[model samples]
Target: MINAESQLFATNTSTLPLILIDFDQTITLQDTIGPLGKFGVNFTQNTKPWSYFVDSYLQEYKEHRKHFFDLPKGDFKAFVAQLDSYRSIERASQERLSQYKVFQGVTRQALTDQANLLRAEYLQPGVIDVLQEYKDQIRIISLNWSKDWILGFLKELELSKDCIFSNDLEFDESGKCTGNIIPTILTTGDKQVAIDTFRQQFKTIYIGDSLGDIEALIKADLGIIIGNDRSLLDSLADFGQETEQDIKKPSSLYRVDTWDQIRSLLQQHRSI
Candidate 1:
């Protein structure tokens, strides 16, 4: 548990920096999409197999990337425009799941069970410790499909669930999934909007890892990209070309391979 005395630097606790964390590959060792798809398939009846949806989504993503890569690479505006175009692909995939009723019969208890299966195997080492230490200042902002799954995962970690903000699986009064997402967050732009809502209340440190995280990362006071993934940096290099500001500068945006580095960074800010 965090020592309450250590948080006494600020008279108004709301002035402290808010740690907005991303789920999926940022917190877990692997992306949850595939596992989540398999879970949905196991519990619900669908016209096609799980791999069919997976293949279809990948095909569309690959085609989009093929065209995206062919576009002039050095233009930041063009790069952002291209990145935002991914929302259509995301929407199409969601629509396919809804049309097929892929998760229609899943129960809340089943989601909790799936989270338990993932909790021990998927979480990145040291993530739980960092989260527990700064629990009061942390808020999970994710593009994940199920808020309940994230909540369940946090419950397993013995962490608070009050600060999660993400898209959710719709459920009926009978407590079964309705095979539709509430869609509060679907694009990088949507994430930016979520981050912006907190700007007036606290200094923001947004930590994420993906193309979808670009805007939120840039918008925050400090942005930490997890892992050594080059795709995010390579994409930022496009924006780097047109701006006077260097996107890779450590002061504004930093990258790390582990949660220990994040803890170190947060320690430096404990005095603020």
Candidate 2:
């Protein structure tokens, strides 16, 4: 079912193959943005706009608590439109929306620490093992909303450049963020573009969760849905699994709860 005519492509890899992961639910245990937004809303003295923004934003995805990590992009007006269409927003008991800016204490130290903590606790326990096991066979790539934050997380993990894609952040002279995100913040559709940019040449596979992963999941030579509920994934291919418990023990796609499952699945596919 590969879209032969589509421009999906990737560079050849003699080294480890590439992997893309959803940051929020797939890696970190919580939606990092809500906290940052909360902090921003508070930092701004609970201004109407900021508070409305926070309240409105969080309320939009209340039903998809699992998809909390998927961040939106572009201007406030556009985001407002997105909210207007979201079922969570429509179902909310109240219509009050606040535009609060919650800053998450994103100093270099705080951000770095948070990334490290996420890697240690929230990320799949055997992530390093999978990466190490496939070190020469796979590469790692990411498409996430907190591009800068993801970049920082990669840096903390010591991943090389070219292994990640995120939005650009402008910093002040003191190295603090200027409270602006790049317009091209990576989204589900953006990963296909990133793949094209790489001109990848290997038999590729992509792993992710949620509707945001539809493009990449369908584009890759092989696609895997990590959290199951594969009504969408089923349409793409036979690769879908639920492994939250395995993720708690190890990280793999073969078993249901660990990153090791991904490693095993890849190995099985490669063997075939």
Candidate 3:
């Protein structure tokens, strides 16, 4: 499951400013976790219709989610404590997520058909276009998903698969998913670790959409928050107003609703 993601995208030696992004809701209009849950349900229906595994896991996730949102933003210890506090439920939730097939009760072609239908209906407009225009400069750092699924979903776009860094998904010899994941990016603190490797080499620009994204946003040389997630937006605003007295290091943060705006901003700064 671990291959070189860098090989797919290093088409040039431009030394351009880096564009780091999150997948799922940030790039697509639909979040991937929901579809993954749907896959679990489908598995039960096709195999053990009497099994309550999917339903049971969903309820467990609901419980884990209750306290997961309450954890502090940048505190890794608190985050681990939150996960440990809900370990009875949270660990199982994570296990279920760590394992799942690419398809259940369907042919690969049929799965692709359904995926395409979803793409037409739910994908964020302009994401593929903007990414395509700047393919060589982008690296995706996704938290929740395995690399295979993201690349599979975006293969039609011919996106260079070089720089996507995500957790690993294991599969059996028969291609059935195993309930084990190796996470490279685990906490909000780990985001800073991920970005540090790129900081000295490029003008890192991080783009993300949720509260989990805040740590990286603050750490990037320039950060862009997309969509109207009020919690994140307000946090950025508060960080700007309450934290600093010096005008010299004023926030280089920007918020917008569309990829087009990001394109315009990047185009204006690409020379730098």
Candidate 4:
């Protein structure tokens, strides 16, 4: 269920440095697998049973890719119902979810602390440097699936707001999660709307990994593929397109090896 995220401000069409970033593996060293898996384990003693349920569902979901996207828009009830209907859950999996223990001793603060530690230790070391270098020049907007997670995560990292768009999470009066996403932004390939919402005027650089990023990436003046499993950029590069140009340079479609390399490239480009 994709929901509209909170925005710090409306799009600033006045010339601004506009940079769209992917928050998961592209920025962090790891993806959501670790945190999500930990959540599963803490939920029950028989973690494997739940893992199997999720893995099997994912595999089957991938097998019928088109149908997955064919799901109705803004229909959270139907969407969740379909998702529940498709899965073949064992009794163990059902019990695990029912008794879900979101990791013992894992208060939101503890998980946040660990996430911050990872950001300092495993994230691209030069990530901050590059961002700082272009700090005054471009708006570093993050687009991601981790709605509330991204919000809380960035606050820990001390990154500025007015530069992020993610899924929306609803919280109850006690501050516990309501388990419902509102005005979902991750529903369809709606990333462009995020970019469009920013309403910035600059050479747009859209960076991401999956097909989910296709719409905005294609629309950007600069399209960067980061750790993409799908070879969507091969054809783009074959056309002698530089990041700034429409021409192709297939070999130039690089796979990031380190954060320092990213900093170097961005700094070098900014100087030109």
Candidate 5:
């Protein structure tokens, strides 16, 4: 159902739509972090399911939830800066996670294998078709995995190089991931900065799930939301009751349950 805030923004026929695609639930069926965690667990502890690790990570960050949404925008940005610095140091030495051995050593082939490993099972099927159809206009801007991981995964799909904006992984002299993520210091708000860069140049169409994606969703000329029921519930539960109002979203945004709808919509809107 393409529910829009108003009539869909009129896009130019001569220009291709500049698309910003989210990675987690939007492109993939679920959060990439879950698979990453699974990779970590099996790589480290030889465990299956990955829940133990995820539960622990969430618990560790539970205290921060109080300020996660309520913190002033600038204050939250500053907080991420400090946290990013600290996480880089901590993850580098996280022997268990590094033992996953997927990215610890930074050979190009190893990265591709790891990317394919996850992509084979998890990547959204229809999303890739749309991307290939509009490859030139699409730019993946995700807070999901390392730049190496996203690019490598896309390469496996046989999708040629395209513009991507995301976090990076650092490697040692040996080409091993240092486990320290060099932070873009990105937050949900930073996404606005990204969309703002291109909104004027093209009819920006943003697609995402979760409240972390809410800002870009609302700010775009056309925001296509994936899984409205799930997105709102998860966002509200994750942020708190106050987020109920925030998740109501603007009319400019629309909803779709599957990626095929997105492809169909793009095909419908593109000029002959």
Candidate 6:
């Protein structure tokens, strides 16, 4: 296990480690996708309620899960390939949203306004302190739908906006959403690509909490899974069982239940 005694963090200032954090569930207390969808539905003039889209999306997701949920146990690569297959479900959902113009006519100002309102309610406790302490070394990488939303939310919290790297919601010249998404980081494979891009320059410590983060978490120099997400935990347990691996191995991967633990761990690295 990594613990406070590990020498992994013995490097000097010039070689400070990089922290790649997942935004949606890792940084926030919960997933904001539902709120973001409701925000868009509220602003749109669509005759259908938010439930219409949500239900449709859930149906597709359920079908997708049926085919891939068994998971390839012994082979980690095959397991990740199953996770990557989620891209098809994501694409279909995005396409349906665009088809229905679910977010069309939603103004940028409205999004920022909503973000201001959500900043306090949704942010995870101690996130600000962690972000501040690792300001120079941290990068927010997410599969969130809108980069503007993440930036606006962080700005409202008085955090750095330039550190965000996520997908974007296409907006027209009038600063209104076009109900379309630019699919940049939509899958686990895409997140791994982002991690690899940074791995070229510095040692990486990836923190995340979901199926989408599986590959990136495994690929990083150190991976920290935060929260008690049952699905994620079960999947990792399955993978570990087949491979006869221990998930608590600190040198590779570990799980924690709170940000304070994460902060303490990061501090351990810095103190060295």
On TM-score, the leading prediction is: 1
- Top model number, lDDT: 1
Off by over 4 Å in 4: 1-14, 40-53, 66-111, 135-148, 151-157, 160-162, 181-183, 199-202, 228-230, 235-256, 268-272
- lDDT digits (tens) for residues 147-245 of candidate 4: 435545454335544455654334566665443333334322445655765434345666666545544566665556665454444533433433332
RMSD of 5: 8.4
Residue lDDT tens for model 2, 152-191: 5445355543444554444567776555444342344455
**Cα deviation in Å at residue 34, candidate 2?**
2.7
Off by over 4 Å in 5: 1-14, 40-56, 67-103, 156-162, 229-251
Model 4 poorest ten-residue lDDT run: 1-10
Which structure is stronger by lDDT: 3 or 5? Answer: 3
Q: Candidate 3's residue-wise lDDT over 211-235, tens digit each? A: 7777777777777777878777776
Angstrom error at residue 98, model 2: 14
At residue 254, give the lDDT of candidate 6: 73
Q: What is the lDDT of candidate 1?
A: 0.76
| Residue 174 local lDDT, model 4 | 61
The 0-to-1 C-alpha lDDT of every candidate, in the order given, reads 0.76, 0.47, 0.61, 0.48, 0.58, 0.75
TM-score of 5: 0.68
Task: State each model's C-alpha RMSD to the native.
Answer: 5.3, 9.5, 5.5, 8.0, 8.4, 6.1
C-alpha lDDT (0 to 100) for residue 103 of candidate 6: 85
lDDT of 1 by residue, 153-199 (tens): 77744544447777788999999998887776677777777677677
Model 6 scores worst on lDDT over the 10 consecutive residues at 1-10
lDDT of 5 by residue, 84-163 (tens): 43343333333334444434444545656677777767777766766777765667777654666677667634533236
Ranked by lDDT from best down, the candidates are 1, 6, 3, 5, 4, 2
How much RMSD separates candidate 1 from the native structure?
A: 5.3
**Sliding window of 10 residues with minimal summed lDDT for model 1:** 1-10
lDDT (C-alpha) at residue 108 in model 2: 48
